[model samples]
Target: MSAEEKKTRQMPKGGRKGGTIFPRIALQDAVGYARRLVSKTHTSRQPRDVIYSGVVGAKAGIGDVRISALKQYGFLDGDAKSGYTADELAKKIVAAPPEELPHLYGQAVLKPTVFKRLFDTFQSDTVTRAKLKQRAADLKVHPDETDTCVELYVASLATAGLVSVDGDRITHLASADMSETAAISVVTDENNQSLSNNSTVNSPATRIDAGSDTEAAASDIGEEDKNGFPVPPGNSAQPAPRANFNVNVTLDSSMDIEKLQKQLELLKRFGAI
Candidate 1:
């Protein structure tokens, strides 16, 4: 506990200022632990309740790692010294239908550093084991660490359906079933110009076929309006007025795949799913 010893302690290898660690537990384990924590009571005075209830033992510090994983994933909030407390988001996740837990955990676990790095680096359509190694090299990760990272990625995120990994190929889940906000409808005219909400729209006239009238040409004088136009009442009907709407989609072609992939992950982490 001396000043020099404190300086040497700095922080654990992969740990930040807080006790939280990048997630190490698989998706199922994380979800199961979260569900169990929801049924327990955690008070400010008894923050250890979470660790005690969810983790088996501190053997080799596995228990600490698991607790840290939970905290990193937002299931349990607070640090080791302060104990852990389950927040509203955790409660909702626990109460969510069993089928939906994987998806929820996927989003939450992606917040960890390891997973975030993997996601961001492999945002392309297909990422192989070689690609993973290349990414590791680019990030200055040790060759040995690359293998471990790939294994961890498969066990957690890929297994959770948050991503796809076939053999060595990896893909970002761009079309995942994520929740979207209500889009404002912009009414527009045929000229592609935005129109006011109160604007009136005149629908096109509906055309009807007259019964095989081969002799209708002989009745030109039989039905003629004051304007000298043929008045075929049964053959033509005015269409009802209706609102015309146009959805304006502006695509930024300059945006590359990596940037778009980051946005998708960002949406997931914020619970837009």
Candidate 2:
């Protein structure tokens, strides 16, 4: 290649505004370095020299690359000027329980400034190797290196359980927190709709109009409304204005005696049964 062409190739492409540039290493590799650092220093701050010596040993060039990767992955905190330390997440990944690893790694993978931004941008969409390569190019990574970098980033995400790959297709996996939030929303909506849509208690979802069988059933109720069912409001002639409500109870084979007993006791406490 010509000298000018070679010079251009050396320049970082994706997003090249400023600073020391890319890590050029996968997140797993950087984390291995972090575990080595933690074995000696734990999470305590250490001068860059001491920290580097612990992880890198004699390979100075590879050390720079790996160290840059660690900082990018958020495994390392502090700066060259202030020295470096293993970040809390990094220490946890190295020593925390297996149950905690998935979450910790999910968080760590997004620490890199470039990958995090790209993830946010494409979070809702399925990712492809080609798509990631283009994104890496957008981040100022050189065209030739985009393919290699995309593979590394994808592999790192997979290690963290942050995505599932189907042959050539890759899908972003939801975090446990996101899955939990969605589950809660679904439960709340279903309950709100099922309990009170102005529908009847069982069989038919008939309207609870004035003087409906529902009100007569309440005449037997003493004073206060039981289980939200409207009771007769005194001896007034208003005939207990129409009110819509629904209470659907299902008795299935799975309803064990112990479970049924607890529910019955609760209802009895409230004079509901």
Candidate 3:
């Protein structure tokens, strides 16, 4: 291949064009935009009006970079001309259950900047700014812009509640506490194995006669007796024990009856009579 072609091919995805890569903003900014967008009092307005309304906790004048971040991360919708509104995702964020919020937040944050790459690079409790810079470098970002990417990532994560900031230290948060919802069902098998998403546990004794049991097939739940059911190895009700035995018999035509009698006597001796 030509050297020029090879060089172009080697360029990192979303690599820097001028001094830095594509614009990025803090996580808090996106969260603020989301909060305002879903509030009952919120109305559709130009991006500038929303930013300056002081709902998102922006102390300084809102800039294009901040507005751009909201659009890129899917919090805001529309262009500079026709005005902006809350995107569908923002609505979901407001309505999503508390347990589901973390995953939703993760999806929102990973949409922009070096945050996604830096998030993947994190293998432990904390990720350093130096490490984030290295990730930016890998993305072919300019040395001057690496710090910008790192700062954006750190602030964004802190806003997302995925990490805690202590001066320079960035510590990742434990996974959000998730609980089962109406959309999801968890079940345990006879062996105490857990399954989710309406999964079923196969019963060893209950044979599912599919073609014959059409009515049973209509329901998702397993058929159970009104009282109770035995799992396996029979129920606790005491019953007489039974044994299976195999016996070999030999007969001769000449002395069949006498030989049969002798064999029967031997069977009695062996407790098989």
* Number of the top TM-score candidate: 2
Residue 31 alpha-carbon offset, candidate 3, angstroms: 0.9
Model 2 spans > 4 angstroms off: 1-21, 174-273
The ten-residue window of minimal lDDT in model 2 covers 201-210
Q: lDDT per residue, candidate 2, 1-273, as tens digits? A: 789988777655684434324557777777778788777666467777776687756345666677778877778778778877777777878877565566667778887776776677666568788887777788877776777677877888888777678877778754555466546656865876887884555434343343567776656454654454334455876554443444356899888987777666645444454
lDDT scores of the candidates, listed in order: 0.58, 0.69, 0.61
Q: How close to the true structure is residue 61 of candidate 2, measured as C-alpha lDDT?
A: 62
> Each candidate's root-mean-square deviation in Å?
24.7, 18.7, 17.1
Residue 267, model 2: lDDT of 56
Residue 109 in candidate 3 has what lDDT?
79
Clashes of each: 0, 7, 1
TM-scores of the candidates are 0.50, 0.54, 0.47
Which 10-residue span in candidate 3 carries the lowest summed lDDT?
177-186
**Model 3 steric clash total:** 1
- Give the per-residue lDDT digits (tens) of candidate 1, residues 18-93: 3213466765677667766666634442356445654433443677677777777777776657656676657878
Which digits, one per residue and each the tens of the lDDT, describe model 3 over residues 23-53?
4667666776677766722566555455545
Error of 2 at 175 (Å): 6.2
Order of quality (TM-score):
2, 1, 3
